[model samples]
Target chain A: MANDLVVAPMLVVLASIVAMLALRPRPRAQRVASVAGSLAYAVAVGAVAWLIVLSPDAPGAATYQLGGWAAPFGITFVVDALSAFMLTIAAVVGLAAVVFSVVFVDRANQGVFYHLLFHCLLLGVTGAFLTGDLFNLFVWFEVMLMASYVLVAFYGGPQHTAAGFRYLVLNVVGSVLLLLAVGGLYATTGTLNMADMSRRLADPAAYGIDPAPVVGLGALAFATFSLKAGLVPFQFWVPGAYRSAPLPVAATLAGVTKKVGMYAIVRVYFTVFAGATVGISVPGAAGASPLAFLAPALLVMGSASILVGGLGAIACDTLDEMLAYSSIGQVGFIAVPVAIAAAAPPGSLRRLGLVAALVYALHHALAKSLLFFATAAIRSATGTHRLSDLGGLASRAPVLAGCFFVGSLSLVGIPPLTGFFGKFLVFEAAARQFTASSGLAGGAVIAVVLVGAVLTILYTTRAWTRSFWGRRTPAVEGATVRRSQVAVLVGLAALIVCLGIGFDPVFEFATAAAEAALDREGYVELVGPAGGDGA
Target chain B: MKTTARIVVPIILVLAISLLLQGHNLPGGGFIAGVLTTVAFALIYVAQGLDYLDSGVLGQEVESGAGVFEHRSVTAFRQTFMVGLAVAVASGFAALLFDEPFLTQTFVIVEHLPLYHELEFASALAFDVGVYMVVVGVLLTILSVVGAE
Candidate 1:
């Protein structure tokens, strides 16, 4: 019974998708089932988290082998603290986005495979988070991208179609690269199961494996992940895709799917590849592990993403596009700490770096999704998200504006809010790295974070002042906000506030997740890949 | 083209069914078989027309001027896709009911039962059939819709 809980989230979502599809002709019933399924998903995720990682007698990690096949032969799903924490974030944002979608999207449009695709997206996310095979990860990524490709072009207008096409092309290319990398890895490492690969890579001599090809293969894989995470140089698709997609779907893209990329980075690099003892000669990165190769590259990309995303956000005219750009920068915030953690030796500083990254990711997921939901609320009320066409929403719709205000303040990292701790922990990681390392690299990271924080404040405030304040335009004045949409926004806003106020447990959860992420031995032991030399 | 398609389509479908049935142990499987079946359909559509399956084969009156989405075949294809998904997921859940891991499969061999003599019935065949349905449904849907476009 306890073992069954491991796959419960995925099963619940699959059932929801089937139920929704069965009820496709009945829009009302389908909508209700969608919401009910989302609720069930959240509950299933909660059960997984509690039983697998959080309970007093919990093992802190559990693995379920699909088809009764053991690791190295079967697809494995590992529910560890890291995965559980990430799934919790997905559940929060996913439920909010789905509930918001039911109310915000028109009935006619909702009937056109909207709920179906949305659940498919969730299903993909769940599979990606749980699966322990490298090829399975690629499969899940395709599953996720396939659903999103349609949702992005759901409106089927010219701009939407164009954006979706570009998104599809770029991701197809990314998927190809990912497949190449996965194939290359299988050839190089002789296994696709991450746990088995890690074990083999850890003792290459015993396994007769060459660790050199992995360096190039790892970079190839990293590029695809960076593309998925919407990091710099690969961030071009972010704004157009987010702007074109339905607002709630955009929220899922920004809040949940982006984190899937980040989660993959942490899981593959930190847990799997971190065990590979390889010599790397990257200048700033000094270690004998693949992470050493990752550190410098990640640092440069993370910093650039921060600057590029922030600058882009500040110049955006529409609220959706601005939030889209903001997410790129927020992902940078997540990536920077991961870079720092990759650079740092395994110790307290490393753990702190991971904790900072995880917390920032959680905060960004909540804040950005809340803000997107607020944008959806305003759009539902006023029929526009362009900043120039809107004004005095504060006066027109106080609750909606208030929800947006909370979201914006959280984005700006104001005191007693979730973003404050996210930013503070990130800064603390950089600052501590500065003192401990006594190197130019540490100083550079701190400088980048400081600039990024200021840029965050700048764009968030620009978005707030331009759209929510001043005299009411006709659109704003005539706006009639949907109560349910606003209610969803309010609920998310309340969760953000409550999480921020009661930050202790959240911090503890993040710390455990970080530890789990860095626990290579535990991951391998949990999965226990069979048919190996028992070394 | 019509003569060739008429001759090849049935053979291709038979081969596809063989591939699907032998999927549990042999080289061929649901995905390839599904693709082959779709290819057979594609040849027929190309030789005859999009409405051939409905107007000629199924002996139904074609509603002229109706969009491809309103076409009965397209709807059937979509339903096939949905059913396929449900079947695949249900097959996985069936394992849980039997106190096995999700997607766990088992088989039983019945000896001297009929003309087939020893017949091997594998649980994996159900999963393969689901995959076969999904692939055929999705490909045909895309084919017909995009073909119309």
Candidate 2:
């Protein structure tokens, strides 16, 4: 009976998503429906999220048996504090995205792009949060990624179509690896339900299974997710997709797609693996051997991502392209806390790490979305996206400049802004690194992350100072900015500020969420403690 | 050309859906099926005028989000079916089901004589059928669209 509330929002989003196929209307009417449906779903999801967080559920184990199914058997929908925290942010961000999409979609293109795909995207993302099954998560990924493919190439011009092709290839490769990992997990565990896997894997000593299979699966899973996270070698598609996508699509990709990977990291590492922070012996571990190699590797890779992504951003000349590079860097920033958590054991850092990751994700989603929209407006008025052709726009568009400034400030982690706290927490966690040899390693990684932050400031400042602050140039290709467009940027900027001021509340919420994740049983209980998170 | 796009759009979509639903049990699951459908949609829009396709659409895009694709799909569904290859696979279970006991097999009979070769049931055949659909539908759709281009 209690499950009704938790599953309602998810069902609502899914219903709306499916309903997209049936709603036939005139071309203009279809456009309106697409936009309106996205907004409605976003709002409805948000309302449900708010209610869930306010409910006085106990800290022990909160669960929801969706569709009257029992856990560890039937599919489940969970809403622990951690999931709730993620859901709330995703919902709000989703709403903002729809608002941007209303005006951004090309009229010549698919009318149902907003109507069906947007709802589908919401369904994928919201489903990602609520489901309790590992395979179910993959299902959500498919929904999210498939829709992304269309939106990324919505304009279907030569440039975007080309970019979409690259994106498609990379995504397929990742999905393959993910499938392999799923296969391996099932082979060893004999069950795909996450809770059962978590419980069974927790005491591998008693399960009597070889450790090589799990490690192998984890490695493959890492490869798949790392690609999605745009880590080191797997990052080729990140720039192209984000760069070529229409402004709103870029915003969603930078803000949404990457988060799915990060979310998976937490889902697998902490909940399923319970902060293994080390390797399993069944793969055959000796005394004080390479058990902890996984954690260190994550740290190193995360550090590398920050460096590469920062350099990439600094080198880009187009505003949108630069944002794409910056997204790579931001993803690294989010991954840092997880890497640190892996390298370090349970301590003060874990809680702060969770907070840092969540806060950074939330702030970046808002800031990045705002920045991308601003870039769109800039392109509309300027007729070009190249940085070299753009300068001295303060006179023509101060509001955009202002939006860019606020978003930049928060994103670059300025004081009292929403972005500042996440970095602050991550840094605090990094500062407390343990292990004699890893002390220096952890220390170096932290230094690299900080430098990445500075690079973020440098590039974004360059963008702002040039695009918005410079003197107005004579008539260029793009001219006459729209107030309707400017309104979108302003609205997002306001959100960044409001969230910034309310950081304390946000921090508290994230901490509780972190506690839930660190303790896997709590999350397992939410969706049914036994069932999966899929349809 | 207009008639071609209109007729092909729904056909491709139907083909794509068929490919997708059968994919888990046979060969052509989400991606290929989705792609086939979308390719068809894309083609129709291209063959017919956007206006022609637009006029026939019964409602606004998908009822929920009022999305751009369904609207465009209405017009371009034939041509656009080239791209809607993505399937809403629940998380990652299409493959996971195979990981269960007995290797997710079904009994099937094939090419038999009078005694016992006439027919049989097989689960692996179901899975293979799924794989076949995904590959054929998706590959055919992509090739056709790219060929048209």
Candidate 3:
């Protein structure tokens, strides 16, 4: 079954390369082939997700050993519930972005290997989700980043090039830090396999390793992921990159790629360092877990991200820039639950926190993608994305306006929407943890998250009122939205509603995945014993 | 310059082929061989130019030589790239047919050849061939595009 999981990414990579080569001169055929290829990739990923859901009683994850070699020595791919959930969302978003690009992307841009790079980007994103080891995760991140750099600079304007360069430089630094961390980890545990490393870290004395270096390395790893996730202080690149990129590319980056960073944070912190202790023992105090220290740090950063992103969005002039800042804010919301999950011991509270994070990520992926797609339509119709230049779109392009409205409401966490449930779960989880643990810090974190939620409404409402209902400008009155573009937006809007209204099954699935992620014993057992020194 | 390139190119081509053939037994492999082949073509382009390389050594006068080849060379590199990619993917998937994980290699020894000694072949050789084609095709495509620019 795990072997089947590899087929999804491999198919996309192969089909896209073939399509690019075979139909480069024929733009029409290339478009059709790219859409078909992506849809097929989505189906393959869906099948893998189905396989995971079918056998709930199955122990551990489904592991596939590449080249018939076993764990630690060879590359392994695993499809646990969490990976399957992430893969499913990535595929759905990838398919939607590709479909939207067919008409939204200008012909000039499409001709220059856009489809090829898009699929390659999908390949990287999905590979990151499925890989069972840290080294392969880095490889997938590189594959994803290289394709993104090209796509970001696809338009070849000065602003695009400059933004792409900043994105490149920042990520290269992140990559270096990641490599150094991975090196330190391998040197300490003598295994690159994530599960094996986790087991080794659990009992470092037997391996003749000091726990301090491992804990320090874990912090280094966290810093690297923070840069990738665009957490506060490292989020300056988001607005610039999002503002300059082509609409479809920006949508893909916001909707799918950024989540890969969040996924890494969850995977590394929860699975690798879950049982390992950090910090020093004092003469009179009980030994504090590293997570106790790390969790508060994450909460502080998450709060700062929310404040900066929300305030920045309110100050932005253009619709794209506002949404870019909004992404930073939403990422902070997702990080809040991660902090709670990490801080709490393994139990229902931790599970709740993890589930909240997953739910938030899913909602954000859908809503954010819809918003960016709406931006594409607005930019194409009005010849600009500046909010002040646009108005009265509700009467002219009702479907487009409606799409934006629905996406906005969802993003703001208005009642009976997907985002509302996502935020509710995180808030509920935080409150529950606070009461159960009797920690005053948890109460403060809850207050910060609530304030962040309110700020979300403020920024989103501001953008909504100005862009959709402020007044009818000349440019807005004359602009015409295409039917195909409207259809794409409508389709995404429909999914948001379905997720909101039919929240039970999705929530249940997220819970199961959270449990799978938390079950360290199951993961280690599935990966099996590492050979030789790795054991 | 043309005389020297003409004299050296064939020897380089032979060396590349030898590298490819001996790859399974030694350090020289598909990637190095493909790079060497590209270097040989690059020397031709540097000495005689794009038109000369595209038309082959015989020039446009030969009916089968210049016109047909020149038109195709522009698109041929692209085709080569895709074909190589497909081949590599196919070889990896071939293991799936036998209930094995992806990219698994299977070896066979053939002893019945009339003119040659017994040879050991692995499915990985096909994958290496695919890699060889991809490297050559991609390098050539890059060279052509850059040269045109």
Candidate 4:
């Protein structure tokens, strides 16, 4: 029973996909099963969280080897504090997005394998989070991307196809790079399992490994990850893809899948590569670890993303486009602290930076998904997501508008909202880094955060006022929002508030996740890969 | 083309089956064998017309003015995909029934069996078969849909 719990989330989603397909002839039953399955997935994630990390007497981390094979020979599935935290974020947003999808997507479209693809996305995310093997991570990434590619082009219109095609082409290139990097790492480190690689990388002399090629390969892999996360220079696909997908699916794309990139960064770089004592030499960076080399690159990408995404959002004409661009900026907010953690001296400050990133990721997931669901609600009622066509929505549908209000305020980092805490921790991390370093780079990072915050407020307020506060436009007059969609928004809005109000436990959870991200020896011990003898 | 397909498809089918059967300890597995089988069908479709499988092979009337979704072969392929998924997942769950971990496999060997004198059945074969079905279903669906377009 204990061993079974480890793979419960993956199994539940697989069963859900199969069950939905089995009932494809009956749309009503299939929809019901989709919802029920999403709920079950959330429950399974919660159970894994409790048993593996949160509960007393919890082991803090556990690994399950598939097919009764021993690690690092077998594919290992790990449930640790970091993955559990990320999974919790995915479950919350995924459930809301799936529920919202049933109501927002047309009945005809829902019958066209919508539920199945959604579960496939969840399964991919779950597998990516839980897999302790490098090659398995790439496989899961492909699974996630495949589902998303179809979902982005779900409408099959010219514009949708165009956006989806661009997305597909870019990601195919990214996947090729990732595959090359993985193969290169395997050759260099002599292992594909993450734990085994980490063990070997920590002591290259014993394993007859050379860690030099890893720097270039790691950069190759990071480019793919950054593309997935929608960081700058690789974020060209963000707005179009988000605008083309079904609004609810866009929410999942923004709130969950983007974070998979962030989670991978933390897991692979910090947990797997941080222990490698490689002398990294970049132009302006100098350190004895790969994290040092990544710090400058991540910081630059993150800061640019903040500026570009914010400016793009400010100029967007539609609500969904604005949110899409905002997602890029929000991910930057998540990435900056991770960069800080990477550059820190691997102590309290490093842990603090990771905690801040995790907290911000959770906040972004809830708040962004809430806002996307609200946008869907507006479109469902008014048949337009154009800011110009929407007005006096707050007076027309007070509840829906209030939910939107909460989401926007959270985005703006107003007090007693989840976004406030997220923003606060991010600034806190950046500020501490600035004080510690007291250098030009540190000061510039803080400045970027400050400007980014102000830009966030500007765009979010523009959206709120333009859509929700002005005189009643033709689209807004007599528009009746769906109660079910509004209910989902309200639930997420309330969750954002609740998480902020009762932030202590969540903070502790994030701290534990951060610790888990940095605890390389503990991870190596948990998986316990045998030596070359394969005993 | 039709004559060539008629001659080559059977050989390809035989080779595919042999590969799948010997996949447990050898180079060929469900994925490769399934792709080979799909290639055979593709040859048949290319040599003959798309409707040949319905009108010529299955002896069913090919309905005019019907979309690919309404085609009988396409529906069968979809069902195959779903059933293949269920079978794969169920095979993994089968280990749980034996109090082992998910996807754990075991084998049974029978001595002095009939004319062969020995027989071996590995549980992993079930999973490989499931994969074979899935690959066939997915590829044929894509082929038919895209080919029709």
Judging by TM-score against the true structure, name the best candidate: 4
lDDT of each residue in A1-535, candidate 1, tens digit only:
6788989999999999999989998999999999999999999999999988998999888889999998888999999999999999999999999999989899999999999999999999999999999999999999999999999999999999999999999999999999999999999989999999999999899888888788889999999999999999899999999999999999999999999999999999999999888765656557789998898898899999999999999999999989999999999999999998998999998999999999999999999999988888888889998999999999888999899999999998997889999999999989998998878988998999999889988998888888889989999989998888889988988988999999999999999999999999999988998775653
In order, the Cα lDDT scores of the candidates are 0.92, 0.68, 0.83, 0.93
| Per-residue alpha-carbon lDDT of candidate 3 for residues B59-142, written as tens digits (9 for 90 to 100) | 443334433324456467767777887787789879988988888888889998888768878777788787788888889888
RMSD of each: 1.3, 9.3, 3.4, 1.2
Q: Write the per-residue lDDT of candidate 4 for residues B40-119, one digit (tens) a residue.
A: 99999999989988888888888878887888888889899889889989999999899888999998999988898988
For A1-535, candidate 2 gives per-residue lDDT tens digits of 3335555556566545534554544456665666666666666655555565644563333455433446677665667677777777777667777667666655555464455676677778877887777887888888888888887776678988998998888889889889889888888866677877776676555555444466668778887888887877777788888877767767877787788788787777777766232344532222221224446556667778888889888888899889888888888888888876654556667666777888888888888888898888888778887877777777667787788889889888887778888678777777766342355666686689789988988898888777666655553323687888889888888878887888887887787777877776655444444333231
Instruction: Give lDDT tens digits, candidate 1, residues B25-87.
Output: 998888999999999999999999999988988888888788998888999999998899888
The fraction of reference interface contacts (C-alpha pairs within 8 A across chains A and B) present in each candidate is 0.96, 0.00, 0.84, 0.84
* Per-residue C-alpha lDDT of model 3 across residues A184-269, encoded as one tens digit per residue: 98887788889887777777777776666766777788887888788998899999998888888888898788889889988877
TM-score of the B chain in each candidate versus the native B chain? 0.97, 0.39, 0.84, 0.97
Of models 3 and 4, which has the larger DockQ? 4
What is the C-alpha lDDT profile of model 4 across A452-507, one tens digit per residue?
99999999999989998979998899698899889899999999999989999899
Global fold similarity of model 2 (TM-score): 0.77
**Candidate 2, B10-99: lDDT as tens digits:** 777777766655554577765676457546655755675343334555443344344333454323443322122222222212333454
Q: After superposition, how far is residue A282 of candidate 1 from its true place, in Å?
A: 3.3
TM-score of candidate 4's A chain against the true A chain: 0.99
